[model samples]
Target: MLILQSVAGLLILPSLAWAISEDRKKARPRIAAVGVVSQLVVALMLEG
Candidate 1:
């Protein structure tokens, strides 16, 4: 689970960078949503 979270974090990095650099304005909100969800998942993983 920890490894999966780390891999997800790693994957998000480059995609986030591209989103920041590219013209994908619509993707920003979706990215933010994913980030929030990921944080919640991580919290659940840690607490459990």
Candidate 2:
């Protein structure tokens, strides 16, 4: 579980960087939402 969480965290880093680099201001919110959902899914999957 800890390993999964760590891997999830690592995976988010590139998405975060991509979000920051995006010139389309509108896409940021979507990217952030995806990131949040991804974390929640991983957490729930691990916890349950």
Candidate 3:
């Protein structure tokens, strides 16, 4: 759980940056999808 939390925190940076974006809304979704997948991978690694 702790490892998941830390990995989630790392993923938050890109989202926060995305949130701050004014004109790049379209690209944010793609970036977020990638972030989610990355977090999933991190969690999987912890489980394995």
Per-model TM-score, in order, reads 0.44, 0.45, 0.45
- Whole-model lDDT per candidate: 0.73, 0.73, 0.76
Q: Can you tell me which runs of candidate 1 are displaced by over 4 Å?
A: 1-27
Cα lDDT of model 1 by residue, 1-48, tens digit: 986976697678757776677567646667766876787798779979
Between candidates 2 and 3, which one is better according to lDDT? 3
Q: List the residue pairs that clash in candidate 2.
A: none
Judge candidate 2 against the unseen true structure and give its global Cα lDDT, from 0 to 1. Answer: 0.73
For candidate 3, the per-residue lDDT at 30 reads 71
Candidate 3 lDDT tens digits, 1-48: 987877777778776877788867466577677877877798789889
Task: Name the 10 consecutive residues with the lowest summed lDDT in model 2.
Answer: 22-31
Candidate 2 lDDT tens digits, 1-48: 988877777677656676678574555666777877788798789899
Query: Candidate 1 — number of clashing residue pairs?
Result: 0
Query: Which residue ranges in model 3 land beyond 4 Å of their true spot?
Result: 1-27
Worst 10 residues of 3 by lDDT: 23-32
